[model samples]
Target: MDSHTKSKDSAVCHEICQSHKNKVIKFFCTNHEFLGCKDCIALNHRKCQIDHIEDKCAGIGDSEEYKTTLIELEQKIKAVDAVIKKATLQDKEVDSTYDHVIKEIVKFRKEINDRLDQLQKQILADAEKKKPEDKETVKKVLERCTDLSSDIKNFKSKLQENKTSQQDGQLYIMIKQAKSKLNMDDLKNAEECLEQTDTLCTFERNKELENILTTHNAFGMLKPFATPMTPGKKSVSVKLTDKGEINIKTQSDRNGCQITDCAELSSTKLLLADYNNCKLKVVDTQIKAVVEEKALNSAPWCIAVLPEDKIAVTVPDKKKILVMAIAGKFSIIRRIPVKGDCRGITYRQDHLYVLCLGSKCVLTVDTHGKVKNIISLKNEIFVNPYYVLLSEDARYFYISNQGSESVVVVTLQGDISAVYKHKDLSAPLGMMMLDDGSLLVCCYCNNTIHHTSGDLNEGQTILDSGLQNPWAIYYNHQDQEVYIGGYCNQLKIRKVASTV
Candidate 1:
């Protein structure tokens, strides 16, 4: 049955107006959206624009709202189905993951047992290696002592016989001979060996292994995620006081450090893109030193740490995204090839929004680097196209240019929002947004960082010194520090004082 027919039959006063039980709800007030009898309309909806129900339903199927409803219904179904499919895939992944880990655990246990067995065998082999030598030394001493006892017994018998025979000359001669033939060297060797105690072999367990086994909670450790591309909503108007500078320069750097970008691996560790050096370096922020470095096939322009141990580096010359695994060390796990030379890159909702410097456009790509869509800036006075970042709501994003005074605000459809220009925004390299709706941008050539209102309309320089040609920037809210780096300058970390 139709909804209207059901509505009339379902209630005690179904089609009848609640305000006037004797009259049916035949009119719909366009202004107030009310249904009432003639007397009720005169009292309550006299000023409202009224439309008859029949007239309102005349072209319902052809109406825009009806079309929108159809589209929304299909979209909602697809959205719900996508969620269900993802959840189901995740469920299957969980089962497979358990199976894989169990196998690894079994394999690891066997490896541990094998290593322990090898160690045990080595200890036994070492003990046995010296056992025979030591045993022989003691046995030789025992054999000499037994021979000496026999000589003593034979001499006593001879001496007793000589004394009983009353032959003084013979007895004296025998005693002299016995003293001369005593074999003192043999007796001394036995006595010296018996004088000292033998040492027993011992095994000292590995302290490090013992500590790890006793103190650790899991075979593979679990850690919270690293600092994202853009962290929580932090104000750009923060005081960057002198903390210290992390010299990203290393012994292998052939040219001046052109740190195009840097990422925080954790609170204490950082990852830097050495453009001129053609290397990626892992820095120990506490020591202000580079702890690990990985050479790249091409100069790396940007670094983006993605979900679950993955990091992406944009190699513009190579025209590919070097997908790396960031664990204790950086390893090139895979490479995602793009159509054009790529520079600036950011990740959101499992897609990489990359700014292609040569093409002068932004490509929305999957984690695999397959181009899903492109946001072109070929028409605008697009300049450097160094970095692109999505807004907090992901509705729109901003792109920076090194040669232009204005920053480009773009929707997902590639439509321009505004091209606000300012002197302080000169050579803007990297851009970030603050929680208070302020945008933080790095002025590369100006050697400064600027903060503007969320709309990029009003702004001023907050930091203007100690950073030379600042190319990349990061504001860590948890540590209350601002990290800025650039050409000819080591990455500097400054303490963030406040929202002021």
Candidate 2:
């Protein structure tokens, strides 16, 4: 239904007014939006003065409540008006750009059409100019000669009876006259004319069209749509300040650099390798809870958590990988002795990929500890071979090589794909790829986390505030945060900014 009709039918109350003052008259009450008699006014509003109702109504045209409401509405309207004004200015710019592009498009189209018309007109004009030429007359003569020759041939055959010899001679004479009148040269010219009329030549339309479309940008959207002018959500941006007091400082027993592997098992617990102690210490991040200190027969270099919460440790010094249940029972699952030491390790899809430091190779081993593939990086130009990261699709692999001073991208076939070089990065250790396809690299020597886009350029120091020798980087898409570990005041949890 129409808005006016609907509003009137709804009969929502929006005003107030006195009935009347004593007088023998009737008047319309605009505030109350109803009619009242003089007696009714006295009975309902005895003390209220109602003289010249229209004037009184006009004096208090708008109520205080209404005035306040109107002021608020006016403010709202002004806000919208400002937005519209800005949008109108932007629209004018878009329209101007659109008009410029459209003019080029129209000009191009006209030029193309004009060229096509010229071709058509030229063809028609050429054909019309040749219409009254001697070609037609020569064609008629040829047809006549052929007809007379056919008659002569029939008459000659009849002459074998001897009675039709004179008729045959007359027909032969006619045929000879016709043959002398025939022009073989003109017939050849006629054949050329037929070719000119019937043969189809190349138009070069594509090339001509390309020339007509001089402005390349003219083909795109006339007026690119302005992004919707909506308010964005307010987000909290936290930066680590040197002013805030450090609440916690915790350390693990490194056993004089004998063991170099540590990871946060959970939010509260930290798992560390103590080589001299011949044990793996699980300490608490919050409290002094020595959760578990399991003794091992050999030194453990790296550790991984299996699906069943079992811990898998790789021992390069012992040349063996051990699997221990969470209940603290250790067993030698698969022993893949390597020529070099194992540096970094990760388990995915029932396969363990370990970075062999000295050999410059990544060893992919099955759960049974059998070496499935040895991705040789021996010949690679940059072969520090510290950490390896497989993309979510497991198609592209990124390797952080300490010796090469750059990260190398390798294919699944162990071929050197692309090398990302950054000189500021000294001994790159941890590599993490964000969901937005950006790479976050933690440089150990520099103690800085470099944020780079897909091309690895335009890097910004996203977290140079408090990191001290950050050794590893891990992204948790579930929490939309990145966790940095190793040689920092504490594990730094950073929320990635929304790309949208």
Candidate 3:
């Protein structure tokens, strides 16, 4: 036989199982799509139904299953090709789109400059119109004053002269000219013009507009986001699954527990910052109990987790940040004192982002407690940002503003990307990004938990009745549960039930 005929014969032959060198592979598990010998089937897939190899292979290449699979493969290929084409077009248009935006900015700047020029011309013209009248009035008054001044000198000289009626005549003529021009209109107008204080075409600049430009880096916001290329399917709505609540109140706590903030150590464990009682407690979410508790000299407002069992907590009253290691118990490693009343805090990569409620700004600090950058929020839509959160990708921040009752989205480059405001969302507090990439916000005044997309759209109240003034909310995607604490004594644990 030729070499090709020999290769075809070799391919058609059956092989022995690797598990048992002496035994030929005789069975196939259709459910698991695995081939095995008698010994292998008994040990590995005893529960799975087995088919004889020859009988399973009797599909003869024209079966319904094979035809269906071929059609599905072809459809998938077409779908992938369409996605590829769309992505190519999008990539090609990026530069042109950005160029157009640059042109628009240039156009806007020209318009502003033209308007400023027009305004400058108008004010200058007004000053020009008033200049001649004021100048003439002053000149007339100066001339009269000069004549009188010369008269006094002339009178003095004439007194010194031996004998001169000519000197007296000269003084009399000077006084006559001075008195002739001293009319009521001339005197009043001169006095009024000289006594007037400033307001001569002075510009009262808009302090608010100046502040907006000074505080912010740019006028136009450049937002970059990712969208899945897979063909259409809408979002799956979700609700809080009612697991029983955990009462965080302790014997040492004289007042009701104020859970100002919380952090997830794991899917089933959490660390709670009890602001009212000035305590930090670790809780087991699965068992629904407090695992451990630690007392603090000052109230802890927020938590930022660092690598290697380390965490940073912001103490607003002390104006300090405590770096603690939680390997055994929460023990302070170092104290970093900040300038303002730093409340809400989070960290990404090498920097800590702490929100200054009083200053209306955020401070970015390195792991070693050195300040890196200060992001001012004076010009943003939100008035009082009590809480700040860094996005998972570390590209953006979500700030909860109590004064404006809104959530402002900020990029890491310190730009306001979007502002979320709802008529019902009043005095918004803490926020957590859910597993589904939706955001859950605490409406402190409304007594509701609002869920919305990352851009804060298509929102609905996911939890309203259970929690009261839900201040601290934490979510873990692994367990898909929410651990919430608020103004009350009890800390809550709720499951997230998703429905597609």
Candidate 4:
């Protein structure tokens, strides 16, 4: 027998289970499609109902089911042979089709080349016809310059002769005449003649040709087709209430200071960074009192709440980030030295994202102050990235650019994705991402808080009236409240809710 036939018969006679060691598959588990010896059946298929392999294969060879399978196999083989024959014919026809398409493409290319050459010749001819006229205009201006030089020289010679002859009246008359001839207005006119106008020819695109080349139907009727999108769930409407302002009472040492940054510790507690006073104070939101106060070495510009009762603060001028442990009181854990001045800071997982002002980049560092990555923005997107807020998924980051008066969204890899700017969002300073994939932006110059989508593209005025230089914002998910802090001594709290 041939090797192929022998190999097929050997495979059919071989045992399915190698673990059985040539012990033929005597049992079959109907539910699990398992074939094994008595040992495998007891170990793994104990709970399953098994059948004898001989009983299952006894009449399969001569049964009507076997004849039906043979007929189906023959039909499939015939179908495959037909497909192979059709493919061979198609292969032969492909060469003719390719040649026909090449001929059409070459014909079209030649037509376009001839038309472009004709247009070029015509344009060159028009420019050549206008060259003499343009030259004559410049020549007249040069002649005027020569005439002005001659008149000035003649006046100088006449004045010298009068002075040599001791003719006082003539000399005076000559000087006066020269002064009148050299009037300021006339001199300015001469100077204007010296200014040259551009005479170089430039090409302007032909609108007809541009439309023929760029339109959707330029070469043929190119119809756009796309799969229709299924309707999605409707977004829930949000209801915002003006909850008025909360007067944040500071201690005697830190009284009436600008709150630059605020972070929610709990439902009724908040961490406020006293920028001007160079202090970080934890305040009780319910009673509007200071719970604890800590004095720092430098002015704290921004604060970020860390894991546990810890918090990180950015002191820009000091060029370092101070991580403090907050329990009953604030205690310094360690200071992370950075390359540039640190401004805004936020902690996620075990890493801290610090916005460096001097370098114009965001530094990602661990708790031990090891720098992992630096995300720098493109010049066009961000002139000044003041604050950085990472999305929940950590796929994108939103930055408020105070210099550009825009909020920019960038990927984690530092590529600019989108830029959001509105007339109301002037000098956007601080931002907070909401649970519903929206953002709350603090507009310092306009004294307004605007709400935007997660991408920072769509926005509208959420709070406009009772704000004064709103610099920082924080959202309390447990209490469903938003805290706004800025130049004013008071921290405003607003209740927010979502409707269907």
Candidate 5:
């Protein structure tokens, strides 16, 4: 027998090795089957029963054979790496899809706004034109009636002098006949004149306006929503109402992100921060339109607008705040590098207070980007401060901290007065003071808008649902509409229930 041959009666070597081999071992057969170890082929060896070792071996060895195995493994690793890279590219594709959807929705809104604006001007012109026609009709009738009255008075005076002459009688009969003809014409023109009466006037007829209000479906706009518009299998429809429990006029997909900030300029105009998309979208309320949108170079964490139409946005990633005009033009007015993550920003008079997402300090800056004051509240409870709003008098600022789940009322002099807390308060992103001194808080997690009286008590829910992630809430005094912004399956603008 060869030196490598094993006897048939030899006992199996089952002894544990001194050390486990560092290099992996593999085996293959003539049938093209492969396995990791000699142990896997023990049955095949038993069936062969020849006990031939080197002669029957397929030439698998520990030198170039092992090296070849390693090369195969490296190729497999490369294939797996390619797969991982493809997955990463897929994530970017998802992001781009969301971005495109958001842009399309915004574009739709702009078209609606433009159409509504043109329609509003047209309505005004129509009223102006109809006004003259109606006025002329009224003037003609009034003049004819006046003449009839004067003629009757003269006929009565003539009759009093003596027996009425044939000519006087004829004239009296003719005047009476003329009056009858005028009455007949007035009867024929009643409906047209009434229709013209309304068109000639500029008064807003709630019912008439409601009838003429364009009918729109929010389904298409909400197609890109991050969440199911309807929570369950039940069909959901958002409709416009004159004065109902909920008035849902506009909706747009947030493109799968939640809203972070919202500000209402009028009943027909709003400013929104599409946080995930790094975009600032402007919407029209009256026509449910998007007027303009600007893409931020970095993430737009917060936005504030001045009375002069200038806008300021803070980007945490960029570590700087940008100032831009409403025209979407950036101006190098002020560049603020915050010490921590800048979360919230608001303008009061000539000063700006920035809320830090990482610190408890409120940064105050002037119009020239000069650091004017830093208000530090000694409260250790607040870990992350989000949104800040100033009182109408500019004497106090309200800061909502997500970490503490509390809203802190602070003075311009760095004085703390009150702390409002609710069991449900999670991340209060947006806070607004209503005209009647009520406060509207955007509870992000709950997807609801909470309303509270001046003292922060008697909390009532104005809107409870239909929002994916409401980040901001703004009230437009001109149109009496509330604007909500943040992630909602997509970016969206909705008209709040308002009396005006």
Candidate 6:
């Protein structure tokens, strides 16, 4: 073909060479995303790999990799479109839910108003009943005073007339009779009647209702929620296999330190609570080293990561939860005082769930440290409830009770759903629920990690050989890795193998 005809028939690249417009785009920089002529490539992209457009396009359309990439992109687009559709429907449901809640609130308000009206009416009726008797008492006292005043006036007139016209004996007899009729004690008693009826009845508020309004400061709480983005099930079966372990030792530790809790902060960084060292350490998994450590006032038992680089650590001995801001180091932003010894803690949405070791219950509190509710398993007494974990759906929580030697599944409202116990599983400590409705629990006394279904029934031992006393276990969904910490000095990470 002629040169001009060949150039016309060739795929005319949209990316024009600014420096050489006459030299149509001939080469592409593989290093940087740009199409240029030979001169442009030599000038601006000298270090970049330059390839001719014809050679770069050779067999690309027919290649399996290219075709697969195209198919994957198309599938992703469809998935995103499906998500958009689901989200739109969820938005409509949100509106419906809002309307329903508003109606329910209105109904509740009306009920409260009616009850208050009834209380007011009852109080008014009681006050009304006292009014008639109070009026009668006042009327009788006034009548007695009027009659006594008339008798006194008559007696005084007779004495005055007798003094002028009668003998002294007659006057003296009249004076004695007048004195007998006028009793001073009766007059004094009548004057006291006004004080008795002054405040016969008054309205007083119900102390219990007053306390509820003042203490809680809210009539009702509305917790709004949105649908979460569900992840696709793994194509492989998730199996626990040991990757490696690192012994955690802080500067204060002459020997090794007890790692109580471990949480994945990032893809390659995990936060560890060194109980013996009384410090919180962030470890770099890739480097197998502690990047930063912060000294705490009390020994850290458990930790929950909050939003915006904040972490809540439970100090059982102190009976408080300290919220620390984690940037380069830890700074105590707030301290929440708890009545009982705080143990395992987790943050979900804007609230924190803390397992109270002393009370043997789980308490839910808001971000501002306000107690929302206390959850205790019904008909089951927990002796030493150590760790508590909310399910992925948040409909239930799994609590590991060391004293009871069982894992209790309780609903958010504190109703016991089921209790899981096994001869091999004793003294279950730390617990975590996986996305696929499975739980990984670490046994403190047994030094083993057990895998069970969401109901905490039908499970097998996953790890037991290398652990001394596994106190805490954390599963990283993004990295598909499990981190174990406990009474031992070493922290262990294992690969989560997925089976088909």
| Candidate of highest lDDT | 6
Q: Name the lDDT value of residue 239 in candidate 5.
A: 22
Better of 1 and 2 by TM-score: 1
TM per model? 0.53, 0.45, 0.54, 0.52, 0.47, 0.53
- Cand. 2 TM to true fold: 0.45
- Choose the strongest candidate by TM-score: 3
Worst 10 residues of 6 by lDDT: 226-235
lDDT of each: 0.77, 0.61, 0.78, 0.77, 0.63, 0.79
Worst 10 contiguous positions by lDDT, candidate 2 = 226-235
- For model 6, the local distance difference test gives 0.79
User: In candidate 5, which residue ranges exceed 4 Å CA deviation?
Assistant: 1-255, 265-267, 328-333, 489-500
Overall local distance difference test of candidate 4: 0.77
Instruction: Please give the TM-score that candidate 3 achieves against the real structure.
Output: 0.54
Candidate 3 to native Cα RMSD, angstroms = 23.0
Residue 342 of model 5 has an lDDT of 82
lDDT string for model 5 (1-500, tens) is 75335532232233332233442323334443433235544545434323223333334455686789999999999999977865665465466456656766777778778987898899888877888987887776666667666866765665554344557776667667656655665544554555565433446656754754555754254443311111232211222122221222234433455457776554556677777767777765556656666666777877787767687888888767777767445454667687778878998656678877666678898766788788885578676778888766455677877878777777555655557788767677788876655577888888777665545544555676666667777766655456666655333434544432
Model 2: per-residue lDDT, tens digit, 98-176? Answer: 6546666787778778987997899778766566454675566667556656755665555444444556766666556
CA deviation > 4 Å runs, candidate 2: 1-290, 295-299, 328-335, 454-458, 487-500
- Pairs that collide in candidate 2 are 384-403
**lDDT of each residue in 1-500, candidate 3, tens digit only:** 69867655544427788889988888888779887898989999989988876545553477898889999999999999977865665564465456546766787788788987998899888888788876776677678657656766665565456235556766676556545544335545556666662434466877977787786554666565442111242246888888878878877788889998989787677899999888998888767777799999999999988889999999999999999999987899999989999999998756789998878788989977899889888774767789887765455688988777788877544556667777777788888886555688888877888876775645677777877888888887787777788998888778988866
Q: Candidate 3: deviation at residue 145, Å? A: 99
- Of 4 and 5, which scores higher on lDDT? 4
